[model samples]
Target: MTEAIVIAAQAGRALAEAARRAGLRPYVADLFGDADTLALAEAYRPLSGRFGSGPAAEATLAAVDGLAAAAGSPVGVVLGSGFEDVPGLVARIAERHRLIGAAAGTVAALKDPHGFAALCGRLGIPHPSVATDAPTDPGRWLLKRVGGSGGNHIRPAPRGTAPQGYYYQARVPGRPHALNFLADGLRIEVLAVTEQWCAPTPMLPYRYAGAVVGGASEASSLPAATWTVISDFIERIVAATGLRGLGSADFLVDGSDWWLTEINPRPGATLDILDRRTTPLLAAHVAACLGCMPALGAQPADAAAAQICYADREHAPVPDLPWPDHVRDRPRPGSVVRRDAPLCTVLAEGADRQAALARLETRTARLLAVLAAKKTHPEEAP
Candidate 1:
């Protein structure tokens, strides 16, 4: 059983599921303990409360090594969403094991957003106007963090506000798009092209004003041009950044101009969501990491869109998540449910985004109400 390691329990379980479907053994590792967690590979999403210390990094390294020894497999590390600062740590892990994603040197290429915009311009890719200072007209200048994911540290720049070591880009008005690409360290296999919708408001990290991913129209259903632009952009990104394995890119479509957005160098929250609908995600990631490229298959005409679910009213524990049998990513019993932690999500496929959004929303509210009531009364165990 070759082990595939993932970070954090939720993400680990997702990748593990994908790997298992593709005939590979999955292993999960994290600072947090889980009996349900797999045992073959040492991968986990960091529990920020548990083992988050610098200078004493040796202990963490030793722990990873111990797990690798026990599994009898060289670890293939998949960097989690929040582990952006630890490319060196990733490199160190790969030194003794198998590395699946981009190397530390390539990741360091994106130390600043302004430099990234310059790189895109050099490559003939459309990019937004960038400056260190906020433009006088605040209509579109967007403040972006250089090495952040999930829209963290992102805000709309106001006039006269000076941002430090960040990028202020001209916000182009258009539909948001995402491309989940799987590269075999050489060739391209665009797993899926998702038409994205976002909330029409300023975003706060982890808060759902509307949706980071409002809705999606799968690539197979849309115009072939959508996929063409997306494939070209992925090639440009790989050539510029030297990235491999699981990576997703975001772009803004403003009329005819498709402005480039930052690329997420790891599997996204939507990765498994798309995988649940299409080709095997985790298996493909592990295969690509080992230098294999899968076929480019079209998705269903109406694969359900991945909508972000957040709490507006006082959020309470979902007592027993009456999750539809189809939903994955089961939250632990003691996990906190707030704006920061997503309550739950759903998959809806139909003619349009409105129908899918509504169905997921109804299911989320009902299931969460049951969980929230238990948070208030723990004595009333399910």
Candidate 2:
């Protein structure tokens, strides 16, 4: 069998590792080419582009074609983050290779602000009020790019001149929640519900921080009405979008009221929490994308949390330090890292969501301190 190809802005390390556990060699294309991901992938190519902006579609196509030729057959592609802005490019890629996720048309519908809102209205799914024009009160609304992912394109509205391809959404107060589900176009299977948080910095208030996955036991504590609302909304969305394969629905949950925020039509960051080696998620993602609805086995009992560690200030990358086993996504040495840019991802686990999140927070703080201290005394670092 030809190896699977995974592409994203930063090719997901979790996804690449899951592909390996699924017994398939993965050829990955992305911008970062992080150390761990490169080690796991059969071959790695760097994607040329910035996040939030559209992907480098031409470079991706060239890389995929080369990989397919080297493999002696056409390899299936599992697209990730950056394609959200380039549905046309996705369509072009699908025309040449087998795509293992939402088709181009589906992506267009989900990523289009007006189209998604209309779909939600048709299906009676509760969505926040959205408008094409900036609101009178900037504090009451947020400006969001139509195809932005990773919270990079969101900001308080009524600020300086808004960027192109932006729309305004009524700001709602609530904790962020994401529902990871697998679908076979018509049917939907709920995999896990994760609590997501933003690590605010001076430059970006909604910078994606991390997520705690699973936590069904913890979710049970919410009002019964909350589950009903979430379930009904998920069912309606699947029916309306005809989404297939690994996907997630982002929500802002304030008490029992839930507001649909965004639809992620590909494997998302929450994969770190839901991955089980017994039934690796990448294999399931591919299977679902190929028109099969794989069974969602029981979620793991222990919840997992993954946090993005950001650089506090402009710093020259330190030499090797005693990074903990849980650390991944480390920035390369001698690289100049800007403030608020992600330095690495730290992972931790506990029996429940709160426990996992707390541990992750503590671990993250310690890691940041270590990084800071190591910068001061590079000779002490290993």
Candidate 3:
């Protein structure tokens, strides 16, 4: 059987599981192994062994090379979650193995906020207004790192931080909406739109909580606009970047208008919802990354509105498990109560958004404590 290379442990779990279920061999890269991964795929290499010291370059290269040889042909490299610094490295490594659909150069574009913002404008996509050096007419603008991969560190101008090398943008002022999409350059399949609300306070306190402070449910349409501008923008980006695999774009909605907030170049926090509403966007993402377009077509998630729920999110404060070593989305060690995969994902098939949400709320209350984290994640918006 043919094989694939997945660089992330937590982020790549669904993809790895889908691949194994489809009868393909999966070689995961990680620093260590865990019970969660035992049934999922094979671990090929530990990234730390490669990055810990510059002198270990030869050893690192050898380790990745052995993995390429083992996977054998048309390998697909998944960059994993929270990996923003090594697009060039990922490109070089994958290209050497003749891997298909590796968009290293395109991903590098994320580094330039001004250039990327201009490009988005040309494509007729809606991006929040921005200026790198504090525009003369600063309008609630924010200085952000184009290389921001995700999690905390994304917030309003919080005094002194990445002062010099930062990109600026007008913050979208409304509830956050994220769309999970699978694209193969030629086609883009939007699977789900998750609606999230933050607490009056930032989720946690200042970014140590491993979990989200408030609650999140799947949303169907922007309150007034229903996200048409944002939807068109994603299609434009797919055409522009030729980005393959699954990815997400976050936005802020003000009435009917939606403004782009950030981009996650890989599957992110919405995976659990997607897997519940749709048949794992990862399966199709992997296929697209391989240049293979499965016959699957796009559709709204589970009957107009799918109600996905989460409570007691883990904060980043807990010790981060070794990179590339992911357990199913479960409660962390300090978690007084154990949790299960998804906590609770309810599909209100054929029900209106309200009915679906009601059912979801009732179901989630039954399964989770809905307890806020003792600490908060810095990047979490209020």
**For this target, which candidate reaches the highest lDDT against the unseen true structure?**
2
Residue 140 alpha-carbon offset, candidate 1, angstroms: 3.6
Over 79-100, each residue of candidate 2 has an lDDT whose tens digit, in order, gives 8888887888888878988888
Look at candidate 1 and tell me the lDDT of residue 74. Answer: 43
The window of 10 residues in a row where model 3 has the poorest summed lDDT is 205-214
Return the lDDT, model 3, position 367.
38
C-alpha displacement of 2 in model 3, angstroms? Answer: 6.2
Give TM per candidate: 0.79, 0.93, 0.68
lDDT of 1 by residue, 1-382 (tens): 5544534322355555566665565545554332234332344433333223474345556655665555565446555554454556656767876666777766666445666777887887787777876487876676765565556467767677555546677777676677778876555677666665443334563222222222244224335786687688678778777777788777777655677776776777675456653557766776676767765355545445555454443444434533565455555445555654444444555555556566666766665665566556766853
lDDT ranking, high to low: 2, 1, 3
Q: Assess the local accuracy of residue 319 in candidate 1 as a C-alpha lDDT between 0 and 100.
A: 43
Per-residue alpha-carbon lDDT of model 3 for 102-145, expressed as tens digits? Answer: 37666666445676687778987777766755455443655565
Q: Give the residue spans of candidate 2 off by over 4 A.
A: 1-3, 51-55, 159-162, 214-221
Q: What is the C-alpha RMSD of each candidate to the true structure, in Å?
A: 4.3, 2.3, 8.1
Please give the CA lDDT of all the candidate structures: 0.58, 0.77, 0.53
- Candidate ranking under TM-score, highest first, comes to 2, 1, 3
lDDT (0-100) at residue 125 of candidate 1?
79
Model 2 per-residue lDDT at 133: 62
